[model samples]
Target: MASSGTPSLLQRVSGSMVVFLGLLSVLTSVRCDEQVPVIMWTSEGISLPRQPPPTAGHIVGHQQLASYLEKALNIGPRNVVLFLQDKMSIEDFTMYGGAFGNKQDGVFPNLEEALQSSSSSLVLPAVSWPASNAVIGQLQDQLETSPLYMDPETLSQLRLNASSPALLVFRLPYGTGSDLLSAKEILSGNDEVIGQVMSIMKSQSVPYTAIYTGLQPSRKEAASLSVEAGLGGGRSLLQARGTHRDRWRDRERQQRVKEKPGVYPPVEFKEDDRTCMLLWAKGLTVSILRNNRWEEHDLTPSTFGEGVSPKLHGSNCDKSKGRLVLNYENVLGHRSFKLIFVMSERHYKVSARRWFTLDAVELEYDGTKARFNGSRNIYAPAEYSYRCKSVTSFRWPLLIPRSSKDPANQWRVSFDDFQIQGFNLKGSEFSYASDCAGFFSPGIWMGLLTSLLMVLVLTYGLHMIMQLLTMDRFDDPKGPGISVPQTE
Candidate 1:
């Protein structure tokens, strides 16, 4: 009886545990389905609808939202509405109390009241959010603003029409309790709540801009949501969250390029109408060691001319020997760099190809210099042999030491689409430059020989198998062979 009672007791405990876990899961799921509040203000009044909240991942970015509004509102292509999304934290409000005011939750309502009191013209409060105030002030001051949100065309159209654009502000609830609807659901134009909001805007019949300011979903949540939805676009939600750093880097690179004066003019060496050698580059940049990191500085003709004009010379025009000298100044502060290219023609008997090589590259920076010597062949077809035949990263590191404290402080040079033409007699287009001695090195030849030997062995084995005849002595057993008459 004791043993039976023990088994029964254990069974009851296990069942109860399962029941508790099931209930806990159900409650957790219910909590995740929290509702989000969406408010839209129009000339008529304000409308807040009770609808299911959108999942955090499905939220469309500011640009996509603006595009949708433009089409639905029938705003002309020239006219535009400036959309801004501001993310704020509790600490920001506390730290910038003077700029944001004491009431954090009432910030959106305050903006609405201010807009309502104003006439057709949209008048932002002087003490509103930092981003909002700065944009409005820039517009009022006629300063340069990003054309992505506010372009000159849009502003000009507004001035011509003499009509004020409407301003809509949305204050999203903070925290994970409520989730924003996905872009798909909102764009479908089927959601009751979204449709009602659009209806309100259409009824106003005025060009409008919207501002969504509040705490955004956490990075982890946004990334996961973006993955689950499989969004793809130049400005998809995934890219906004995942590739934010990449975008920032690209922008920085563009800014640096803009600061560059220009590119080097194309230089050609001609021998009796037949051009012997031609050199040009889309852009040239040098990497200098600054603050223990490498930073790129552009080298252009303007800077080069300031010191010594670039020189092009050659012994003959038969794609044999040539030299190029480039001198520049003020590349990085008072520092400057010079590059010399030694060119020579080489023939490959194995490949039956004629190409030119960058025999050596001499780099001089500041008072230090280094020279890299070797046969760096240019590989390309006979037609386009004027270019580098081999693909190179185009970044060559110089051993010149910049810092006495650190031996790793070295300079480097990079070329963007550097092209050399007229190296070959029949060459019309640019070819590639080889950074290596030859395409077929000893190791590569060894690989080719081994593969050939394997193929020969395989062929011999197949031949032997084919030569062998089937045995006619297949078991004299069986019975006597039965013969039939050919006529029958």
Candidate 2:
């Protein structure tokens, strides 16, 4: 007989291990891109190092903020793809900085420097300084162009992942009022950044964002920006911090309290009188205490006047606690101004100023309970079994103005302003308990039928195979069966 020549079990196992490692090396050897594509635009000529009179440290710099964003978004080091606007050339910009340098890192200068050693600055348009409109328009144009608009590697990853591009504009306004580039200038110019961005979002279907970073909240400007973002189905983040002194004090107190034992702050919002409502032309102001802090929400025009009828935007029920957390906001408004945010009363301070929580009105019917935040007459439909908690703040005295000089009065209430909750009166009407739903379509039915048919066919095929295997191939062993019976 021929000698057995097969390899031993150990040799076979070693071969398979080598093959697996070789395949893994081939799979992982290719360079995979992990960078996030970020098109950045910052206002030029604004002294990033300038110090404010009241604040000890300088205002937060754009470059520093950008660095924080990179870390927040998980962008890889040395892999942040940047866009050089205003005809910036690589020679004019630096990926590195030093002592004599501009004290800015990860920044690109739009204009070329006269001397390689001298400081570089961004080139502005002839029309004005920090023309946000022009920058945004040019960005839109670049996005429409070829993939060369971004780093080659980053573009490859974008194509592979199939992600739409985004914009991040950082502004430290150089001028005041009309000269400043902001969302307020929407209709002022055809090519204005806000308008153009909104058009691009609608026409090209892209994401556009304007990040406002400052030391204080510019309420009016922030509101306008928020409106712009809402129209475009995007986002607006105001990263403004409180007064420097206040922030420092908060940090210190938090640390001290955490370090000390048996020394704790009191919860003040738990009191019944803590919750209060302030009526103003802007909207209804609801104040509540939470975690030793005063939190306020303004139910503005978009929610109450000339907007969608007040209704339950969404709700969450906890059967175990018999409690429901309802989210109320204008149909078209931003989420920041949720009319009702919490149920359990709490209080917190702002800059050492105490503010109380607005108490919720409770109502019970047929063993069902409901609580409404603030004193408002708006109620959810009874069909929803939403035993709405009525607002205790609404009273006859509030209707009569305290003084003629005062702008706000209870008489300001109207159908448009008063009705803010949804109520279903018709018992026959049906609605979704949750925001999501499912449906059975024709395609689904067709697929199910096809599957059943395939299963039946497979079962029949298996049965036929078994029957064939059991059948006698030649004359059966019946001839042998006869002899076996005699022996038995």
Candidate 3:
């Protein structure tokens, strides 16, 4: 009886402890679902800390914009994710950001999708972006003077999530030609819309949709912004030389050739327009095939610097063939870094005619090979350059995909935000160059000089040989003319 009674008492205590733990878990889960406030702004939009209001429609200086953003990011305990909207033009943005079906219709849809899918407390609906001045002021007033509330269940749900204040800022647009617009012009207005966005954020509820700016960046600005966003632009081949090609002149020349052409034989190498690629590598070996032979370029602080590039100017890759094979190998354990392919044409309006098909593209290093089946048809917005109402020029990354499971083969590159698909490799071995060169013809100037020197030396050597082989001989020496005597 005593033993049985002791066992019964022990079971009772254990059961009580179990009940206590289960109750504690329920309370903990309740706490976990609570939501936190977030502030998201598109690159097409801008946000300023509440202060004495400034003149309406007044463009904010770029320095002021950058300073405000930096302060917002560092000042509070909040989460910030900057949506680099103007980083890439509309077409490129779709190609890069649309793979996951995040972008639909236009820029705002993309932003809304991202916010909806995130764990943030609020979602801002898409509206006419770059809203009028009156709209901006009204939105700002509400955000600054609103008392936001959350329901009990919604608040309970927030308990399971981490809460923090967040601020997001977008990049400014770049215009074309001498009409270059300042960052202030693009990022300045729409304050009221931004304020309304803040109010929605404070509301701690799901927004119906996101605001749309409909303000697509120009081609030139897109390129400049891409580099600024760390997506593609870097020390370009043009920048390396401190000189640039005159696109207008090149365009006129091409037009003349085309007008009187019989299958305009793939524009000769001397006449090829500028197309380039940027490569980043340190202590690596890079080579390009010229005349069916590999020409090596070493990457170092002196020759190729920390990054090197080989600009494809019609010679390295035959224009008639429309394909190029770039060979790379890793030596001395220096791995490759990043590569960006830039394509440009004259006139933002004439950008449609340029196209190249990358076929059977392969990168082999460290006994591992990655193959990409490239084609001109694969690039999005299948419209011709001339037919394109908007600018048609853009840049793309040339790197191995990080994962094999990417949808639509579009993989977001980690080295920079540049997106690419199709090329995937698991091994690292090839070393790449960081310097950009226009003419990839191996041994260019050196080869020319060497050949000339060889010809001169050969000519002199032959003359000496001929003089030695033929001699004027006579049986008797004539004092007037000294000549070699023959033993005959």
TM-score of each: 0.28, 0.17, 0.21
Each prediction's Cα RMSD?
29.4, 31.0, 25.8
Name the top TM-score candidate: 1
How many backbone clashes can be found in candidate 2? 25
Model 1, poorest ten-residue lDDT window?
121-130
Candidate 2 residues lying further than 4 Å off, grouped into runs, are 1-42, 46-190, 193-311, 314-342, 346-488
Candidate rank order under lDDT: 1, 3, 2
lDDT of 1 by residue, 288-401 (tens): 678898787776544233232343311234445665545454566633345656667667798788655566555544322344443533334433534322322233432222
List candidate 3 segments past 4 Å from native. Answer: 1-57, 61-64, 77-251, 256-397, 400-488
Against the reference, the lDDT scores of all candidates come to 0.37, 0.26, 0.29
For candidate 1, the per-residue lDDT at 14 reads 30
Query: What lDDT score goes with residue 440 in model 1?
Result: 85
lDDT of 1: 0.37
| Per-residue lDDT of candidate 2, residues 1-488 (tens digit) | 00011212113332212212211222232211110011222222111221111111122232333333433223211111222222111111121111123434312121111111111111111111111212332332333211123332333344221154443332222112454333222212212333333233234323222221121122234333333322122122111123465456547755675687644321101011111111112244443435665455454433333323333222221211112212243322222223332222212354343222222432211111223434132212222222211222333221222233221221122111221212221211222221111255557888999999999999999998888755344454647433334565
Residues 1-488, candidate 3: write the lDDT tens digits: 01111222223433212212212223322211111111233221222233221122233232333333344334322333222233222222222222233333222332333333322111111111112101211222222211122332333344221153322223223333453233223323322233344344445442221222222233444323423322112355335334444555446655765677432212111112243222222233344445666454443332232132332211132222322222222432413222222222222346654332233333332212233333332232112211111111113433333235211122121121111111111111111211212364446988998999999999999999888854455454545665447976
